[model samples]
Target: MGIFERYAPFVQDYIYRNRWENLRAIQVASANAIFNTDDNVLLSASTASGKTEAAFFPIITLFAENPPTSVGCLYIGPLKALINDQFMRLTDLCDQAGIPVWHWHGDVAQTHKSRLMKRPSGILQITPESLEALLLHKHAAIPKLFGDLRFVVIDEIHSLLRGDRGGQTLCLIERLGRLAGVNPRRIGLSATIGEPARTGELLSSGTGRRTIIPKIDAKGVKWRLSMEHFYMKEEDSESEAADIDALPVLEEKTDTAPANADPGLGYIFEHTAGKKCLVFSNSREECEAVTSTLRQYCELRNEPDRFLIHHGNLSSSYRETAEEVMKDDAQCMTTVTTSTLELGIDIGRLERAFQIDAPWTVSSFLQRMGRTGRRELPPEMWFVMREDEPDARALLPATIPWKLLQGIAIVQLYMEERWVEPPRLDRLPYSLLYHQTMATLASTGEMAPRNLAEKVLSLSYFHRVSQDDYKVLLKHLLKHEHLQKTEQGGLIIGLNGEKIINSYKFYGVFKENEEYTVRCETQELGTIVSPPPIGEKIAIAGHVWTVLDVDHKRHLVYCEQVKGKIPAYFGLCAGDLHTRIVQRMRGVLQEDRSYPYLMKNAVKRLETARIAARNGGMDVNPLVNLGGNMWCLTPWIGTYPFITLERILRLKCAESLGLRNLDTARPFYMQFNMDADEEGFFEILRAELAKDIEPLELIYPNELPLFHKYDEYLPPELVCKGFAHGVLDVEEVRNTVARWG
Candidate 1:
């Protein structure tokens, strides 16, 4: 039969009802693979190009034709919001076909989950963390829950391909297959997969099956892109000083709005007035600040608040309200969000998206921008760059508008080559190993130490972990009472381990803070950590609140609404700037080229920076002498290499060169005092580069660098090895030093 005829009736009916003129290329290709082949499938296509339906239509058809004896399919996603969205979409389609669709996540109702448990049939969509909980709490129900599972659908597969979370997902799938005694075909779905071969390999890691990545021809996509830059103040620029004085008085755009508002916030307020949009910030703190500022603008204007906020830290009610408001066809609302909404969540018919600054990767930019242009409209994005105006004696680097150039680089990279960040597979994932070890012991009843090590280390992610290293970890666990030795000489979860595993927080592999729930007279205002004393103010829920009372024992706080601005506190957030972005930033300083995406203020700033760079001779020399033997080195590498080079100089070559007083501006430049002359410096660096030294030499002796949350509990040596082999880009730094020769 043809692809259309192979759709098992209901899919064809749904297609006909929707009046789709023809099946999307992904759908046509996926139909053939899922219908004809027994192999797993990896479907890569652009956003809103029918990838979700493409993966599901064929799987549903198969389920309809040969219904499983138990739950038929398991859909996994990285984000709870994405899973919820997909559940709604699939539930609508399956309602007509008499196939039950269920979602299991934190936000989902327990009643719905209880129903699923009662029947244990149809599709079960869940996140990895929730799956971890399921495997632990319902160990004996695994076979009954998924005995005849036919397929496992992993959505936004690219997001899970690069980190321990991905490893955890793969491990969960492998464990599930073993426990249920069913080998389900895996289906991977993604809008951005830079390296298909690597992703295919990831998809079929322990499945003992090959993945078929269908080749689909996609047409060109249209985009409405614009970038604008703003100084924090008008008088900060010399040329704009007169214009600033001559311009009209700064009046409140709305009567109730606060006077003297932030220019960038005002600009966003004006642009997103009546449109359904997403304002994206890089961190949760920024997301909260932006939401508060926008809502303040609405209050000042005497208008109904049209702004909503979404992030990982927010309560589920708040996030779901935002999601539902954004989806409502009648409501014109804008949501200020972080990456919580960046994945493939179907929020119907968004008009535009606004990015506060440049994202770290081209993949992130694409994902943020892809949130819009659904429902057959061209994607539209506005880049808003805000920075403090440079002082009269501003240095070369400060004057160069990094965010503007970053936006241009992201666009150009995609426009020219369709480049996305590739997966980083070669890492010693010790953190995840620790998590999986705990999870394995908690899920299973008891096992001998040798048997546990053999089972856990044999997994694909822990392939590099040696038995000796595992022995060390086990010894530590025993010493700390994380595991107990029974009379039979088998390992079982102990009291300390029970305390760690029983907490809901242990379900997630990622880091989390100990948050106190905030409320105002029974009205919840989300969560906060380390709230100030009573009567002190904080911003949350797009409004300021003053602490009324503190209940530390219950981990709750009572607050009353107030009107003011204060910085909100979340945990730390760090950025990883790629080497390519830093290189392009250097080009922006050296080359006299204008990018089309740059707005008026950004254009002027770039020109000024170029002049300064030329005068400073930054283009001609990587190292410049300040006075005597004092010199500064400008190496435009990114964060990882910068870290590696710093260590290589301090630990590997410092004694030979008599280097001291080293100060760095992270991936940009370093200034140091050295006794070695220019020629001597080069000679020492060359000799050091030529020698073969272990990468572990850079690790400080007796230092346990606890990067990931779980690293503190791991063996110190294992943590050091993980940092050396995985965190540091030693090879990149070596290549850079070789260029100096």
Candidate 2:
């Protein structure tokens, strides 16, 4: 039978009712493979390309023909918000066909879960962490819950492809299949997959099935993109030649709020008025600041606050309220959010997206931009690049508009070559290994240590883990009473292990906050971590505040609201600039090509930076003298290589070259004082680079660099090895030295 002919009557009716001219190419291809072949499927297409419908249509039709005895489909999502959004969508579609859809997450109602438990059927949407809890708490119900599971759909599969969370999801699927005695076909969905073949292999791991990636012949999409630069203050632009007045100033309507507020925030507020929009920031603190600033503007104009905030730290009620507001077709609201809203959460039709600054990777850029342009209208993004104008004596690196160049480079890279950041598979995931070992024992009740080791270590993510290394971990766990020898001579969860496993935090694989709630006179203003001493000033909710008192025991801080701006620091956030972007950033300095996205101020800034780079001989040499025996080195490599290069210079060549007071502005440039000439420095570096040294040579004997969260408990030797092999890009460092040669 043809693909559409294989569909049940209800699916056809829904398609016809929606006036879909024909099945999307992806849907047709997916149906043919799913119906005719028993192999897995990997559908990779752009946003709003009907990938979800493509995967589900075939499965639903098959279910209709042969209804299973229990819940027949398990849809896994990386984020709880994504699961909730998909749950509603799938429920709406399935209900019309008399099929039930149930979701299980922390935010989900217990009543709906009880209903599913009483009579499990249709589709069950869940997050990986929630799935872990289910397997732990309802161990015996596995068979009855998914006895005849036909499909396992993993949405946003790209997000999980890199980390142990992805590995955990795969392990859970395999374990569930083994326990339920049903091996379901797997289907993966993503909008930003870098290596299709590798990710396909990952999706079908242990399934003994090949994954079919449907080729999408989609036309190029038109983007309403623009990038503009702004200084924090007009007087700060003494060194920069960018004429602020030359930039196009979007005129504000009289009905809109005053323009004296933060011009960037004002622009966003005015543009987003009477429309649904998403204002994306890089961090939670930024999200809070943006939301609070926009609300303040609304209050100043006597306008209703149409702004809402969504992030990982916010309470469920607050996040859900923002999500629901965005979803409401009648309400005109905008949400200020972090990456929590960046995934495939269906928030109805959004007018546009605003990015506070450039994202770290092309994949992140695509995901954030994809949040808009849903339900038809083309995707649009306005990038607001904010920085303090460089001083007269500012160095070479400071003169360059890194964020603007980065934003342009991201767009051009994807536009010209369709390149996205690839999955990083080679990492020592010891932290996650610790998490899985505890979870596995907790789920399975008890098992012999040999059997336990065999099962957990056999997973593909653990292929690099040695038996000796695992034994060390086991010994440590035993010493700490996290695992104990049972009467049956097997390993079981011990006292400490029980405490770790029983907590809700154990469900998640990502880093978490030791969060403290922020309040002002009993009204909560969200959360902060490691609050300052009483009467100390802090910045949050877009304004400064002084802590009147602190309840450290209860993790609460009482602050009276104040004014003015201050940097809000919660934790460390690092950026991973791709090699291509850094190289293009160099091009931005070397070439005089003008980008259409650059506004007047940005264009002038670029011109000034290019002149500085040329005059400083940045194109001809990696190192330049900055007078008085001080020098600067520009090495435009990514993060890992940057780390390695810095260490190699300091440890191996610094003393011989008489280098001192070496400092860096990260992946961009390094400044130092050197007595020896540049040629002498190069000779030393080249000699060290030519030597075939062990990875351990990169670290000092006493150094125990703790990079990962759980590295503190690991043996120092293993930790160093992991850091050297997994974290440092030695090849890039070698190449940098070769350039000097």
lDDT of each: 0.82, 0.81
State the local distance difference test value for candidate 1: 0.82
The best candidate by TM-score is: 1
lDDT of 1 by residue, 4-121 (tens): 9988899889999999999988999998898899999999998889999998998888888887778899999999888888988999888877899989988788998888888998
What shift in Å separates residue 721 of candidate 1 from its native position after superposition?
Answer: 0.8
List TM-score per model, in order.
0.94, 0.93
Q: After superposition, how far is residue 478 of candidate 1 from its true place, in Å?
A: 0.9
lDDT of 2 by residue, 94-201 (tens): 877888889999888899999999999999999999998898889899999999999999999998876667877987898788779998999999999998888888
RMSD of each: 3.9, 3.3
Error of 2 at 322 (Å): 1.3
* Deviation (Å) of 574 in candidate 2: 1.2
> Which prediction has the highest lDDT against the true structure?
1
| Model 2 per-residue lDDT at 569 | 60
Which 10-residue span in candidate 2 carries the lowest summed lDDT?
A: 236-245
